[model samples]
Target: MFNINYKSQHPIYEQIIDQTVLFLMEGVLQGGDKLPSVRELATSLGVNPNTVQKAYGELERRGYTENIVGKGTFISSSHQVEKDLAHQFKESLKEIFYEMSRVGFNSDYIQQIVISVLKEEEYVTDTKS
Candidate 1:
């Protein structure tokens, strides 16, 4: 299931893409699991079919999903999926770091913030478990 936030600055397709990747990373969507058809998802989300198609297209490009002729799109099973996701995360982090650096934030400060956030999240997760 997808949730769209109309107020978010992120485009609908990008939001879908991000949520799909998060689902895959969290193991909520596993290998060979079928994705909702574009039309079905669009209707459910009240978005254009083209937007859903764009998200699926990006997922396929990133090796997260595969489209089988006559069979709906399914999550990829290759270990490469994890590798690709890790690489994407690194790239995104690098971009964030660069932006912060441009704004005069030092590496140490960024690292401290990151570590603190990670620790807080870990603590919360541990408590929940």
Candidate 2:
């Protein structure tokens, strides 16, 4: 369900975390679905089982998943994924805005850019329909 890029600056476990989140956000992995075994996933991905275990541990800590002994890891349904996605988006936006400011972009220009993108997204959605 995920492809690892060895050349990427990010760690393998981090990539797993990212892809798992994306899968949940995309509805490719539903709540209550059991994730593959660590050994299984590690063998498939050609990474150490420790890596998958670490990723699973982090996911559980972050409330993205729950581990059931003797059963396995499953996606958590306690939290609304859409709400979580919005929160993540907001955090990412803040980081991007900070970087933009560091690069000399003014708040007004950033606001304009964001507004323009929203408009373009709306136009694209309209065209698709």
Candidate 3:
């Protein structure tokens, strides 16, 4: 299932990619799961088929999905904690750190913030169980 927001600043294809990643991260989509065809998703989202194609292309490029010649696009079997994802995560963190530094947040303060968030996450996980 896909959720599209027409008013969002991000492009439709990017939103689709982000949501697909979220789905994979949340276990809503599993390894080897087949994705809807581009035309079907485009019809559901009321967007051009090319937009969904673009998103699927990016997903494959990012190692999230695999496209078979005649069958269909399927979720990557080794979806959990792949090298591509690890690199992407690091890049995202680097961007965040750079922006925080640009806004006058020192490295020590950033570390503290990250540690606090980690503690809070642990607390939440403990309570959930």
Candidate 4:
């Protein structure tokens, strides 16, 4: 369902996750769709099956997918996907914020860093709110 670049600094599993998420957001892969099995995808991409498995595991963990025993993985239904992902991103941010906090960065520092990063993006404007 996605292409892989072996030479990219990003990890293979993460690349898979990113491409899959992009596909979902871009309407290239629809909800309720079945993704290739781990073996099929790994063989096609010429990567270790564990890599594909890791990607799929992350996708499942992130609320983008659900795996049914004996049936493989499927994207969440369109109706429920938005709601599921809404909280998921917040949960991810919480984890990141917690990690950054442990390193002595408080919420204000984190907000400034986020705003700075947003300001650096050409398409972003007025990130302060």
The TM-score leader among the candidates is 2
**Listing every candidate in turn, what is its Cα RMSD in Å to the true structure after a full C-alpha superposition?**
5.9, 4.8, 5.1, 6.8
Off by over 4 Å in 3: 79-81, 86-129
State the TM-score for model 3. Answer: 0.66
Q: Who is ahead in TM-score, 1 or 3?
A: 1
lDDT of 4 at 74: 93
What C-alpha lDDT do the candidate models reach, one value each?
Answer: 0.89, 0.90, 0.86, 0.87
Candidate 3: lDDT over CA atoms?
A: 0.86
Better of 3 and 4 by TM-score: 3
lDDT of 2 by residue, 7-79 (tens): 9999999999999999987889988999999999999999999999999999999888999999999999876
lDDT of 3 by residue, 51-119 (tens): 999999999987799999888899998734366567777999999999999999999899888777877
Candidate 4 per-residue C-alpha lDDT over 34-117 given as tens digits, one digit per residue, 9 for 90 to 100? 999999999999999999999999988877889999999998775556775566678888999999999999889999988887
In angstroms, the error of model 4 at 13 is: 0.4
Q: Tens-digit lDDT track for model 1 on 1-129?
A: 778997899999999989988898788998999999999999999999999999999999988899998999999998878897798889999999999999999998988777777778885343211
Task: Judge candidate 2 at residue 70 and give its lDDT.
Answer: 92
TM-score of 1: 0.68
